[model samples]
Each structure stands twice: as C-alpha cells, then as structure tokens.
Target: MRRTLGRMLADSRTQPAHAPGASNDPLILREARADDMPAVLDIYNAEVRTSTSTYQYAERTLDEQLALLSSKQTAGDPFVLAELADGSVGGYATYGPFRPREGWRFTVEHSVYLREDCRGKGIARPLMRHIMGHAKARGFHSMVGVVDASNAASIRMHQAMGFQVAGVMREGGYKFDRWLDCAFLQALL
Candidate 1:
C-alpha cells in the first residue's frame, strides 16, 4: 500500500494542478478513458488487498474494470478519474443504484478511493463535490456509502462532506478471520 501511495503521489507531483474553478479540477475529475483502466485497476486492487474499502478479496482483471466502465458509460453514470496535470490517474469515484428495486431508483451508493499518498491534498473534497453535483443534477435524491468501522479517516471525510452517519451494522462481515463492523453514511442530494 505504501508503495502504491508513493507512486501515486510521485505521479501527482509531476503533473500540473488544474486551473482554479475549471469544473472539478480538469486535472482531477474527468470522464475516464480506456487507457485509464490500468491505473484504476491498480488503485482498486490495492484497496481490496490492504483495506476494507471494498469487500472483495480478489483483485479485478483489467477486462473486468473495462466492462464495468463500459456499463457506466452506457448508463450515462458518472465514472470520474482524478488525474494529475501529466494525466496519470490518482483516484476515482462513481455510483450505481443502491438497490435493484424500482422503489430505490432515486437512491444510489457511491465509493471513492485515492492512492494513500494522494490523500490530504484536498483531492477527495472536490471529487465528492463534483459527484454529488452530478447526482443531484441527474435527479438522484439520496447518496449512500458503506464504510468499514475501522476507517476513521473515511468516516470523518464523509461527515465533513455533509454525509450523516445513518447507521452501523455490527459484525456484518468476517474478513481475515475476524468479525468486522460496517457503517452506513448518507447524504441527501
């Protein structure tokens, strides 16, 4: 994870910062292209392996990520990548239906992940602001996130971003041979 962070930060520093107020930092949030898949996959797989940001244990193949992105593109959903001025992807954020039921159509669950070193640089705040703006513009009424209980930094970030702590599910998952608790945060768009 440290190695991944190091690489991301290094890449971030090499790129130029986006011009002020250029719509979520063009250097950060842009429609992801096909070539960005590899960098996205690396960041995603690293999170899966080292943190509870995702529940999956297996690393996703490039093909899988591409398919997912393709589906999002087809649906016109936001699949944004945070890139440095030199165009390396530093992180990503996106959302899908919170549930498959028709009644839940106005609600969605989203996730944002940044390479460790890319954190604390005001990257996530802008990324999330753009995501929420897109969701609201698209008529989504509610946005949700399920965060592992142990990830305080993420919880704080969510709170600071105007997401409330909706609830916590205790002992909801077993990972690494131990029970894990998960918290749900929600923001009304």
Candidate 2:
C-alpha cells in the first residue's frame, strides 16, 4: 500500500500556481534540503522567541535543525518548505506521528510557519493545501494540528481547510512565563 501510494504521488503533477495578486512575493514550495536548514532555523527561532506557535523555550541550532530534518528524511516523512525567488526560506511545514502508540500509526500531526514579513500574503494556504494533498495520497488516515488558542489566524486557516476543533486543553503549556491553552484540530485525510 505504501509503495503504491508513493508511486501515485510521484507521478502526480505539481499543484497549480498561486493566482495573480495572491502574493507579491514569488514563492515556490518544495521538499526541504540540507542547505535550507539555516534559513529554516532563522524563521523557527524567530517564532519561538515571539510567537506561541511553538512552545519551545530556546532557539534551535542549525545542527539541531539539520538533525531533525535528516531524521524526517530518513523516515520517509515529508519536510517541505516554501522558498522565495532569492532562495530565502519563506516558510516550512511538516508532519510526524501523532502518538507513540501503535494504534495511532496512521495519524499524524503537522505544523506550518511563515516568516513574519511573509504573513498576510496567502503563502500558508497553498502550502497547507499541498501538504494535506500529500498526506492523503500517502494514506494518512488523519491529520492533526495543535495550535495555541490565542492564535486566531492559524485556527481560522485550519478551519478553512476543513479541519474541525477536536479538543481544547486549557493551560496545557507554559511558555514565556505564562500558561497557554492548546487547541487541537483534526481532519480525516
């Protein structure tokens, strides 16, 4: 089943380009490579320090990010990125196992991040669409996103993609010296 699904995705055509005026920036989404780690770390660290998108406390080193990327690649998991024409990493999105339990093997959780300046430009929508399509074709039964309750934009975006709120865990995370709520949204692939 996995081999057949992989073959189908490999033969599938690329998604259509963003419509005119969708985004002023010329962005292309593709699988992230080792060379993209530095740029990916920059965007990820920025979000860590300023946004509740991730509950991580400290910035990750380039080596650490590369190791994570390498693990994903080795596991055949997707680590995708959106790049600007100038080769800067505009954003990245990826998924991994939702739980360690064997029963959850077909469920995955994903996250997406865009550089601060890249927000409000519709970059995330197409990025997510691409990821979801890939996940479905790859036989993932469900896709989940754990979003901070304070992040309205991300919550709305997930909803627009047909994800529904599965649950909300109040004060589930402590970050930046405060308790944070996490909302889980899930979509059946």
Candidate 1 contains a number of clashing pairs equal to: 0
Question: Candidate 1 on 1-189: residue-level lDDT in tens?
Answer: 334333433433333222123244455579888898999999999988888878888899999999999999998888898888777778889988999999999999998989888887777777787788888889999999898867777866776677766766878977777788787878778
CA lDDT for candidate 1:
0.78
> Can you give the TM-score per candidate against the true fold?
0.85, 0.85
Residue 163 error, candidate 1, Å: 0.2
lDDT for 40 (candidate 2)? 90
* Alpha-carbon deviation at 64 in model 2, angstroms: 0.8
Which lDDT values do the candidates have, in the order given? 0.78, 0.79
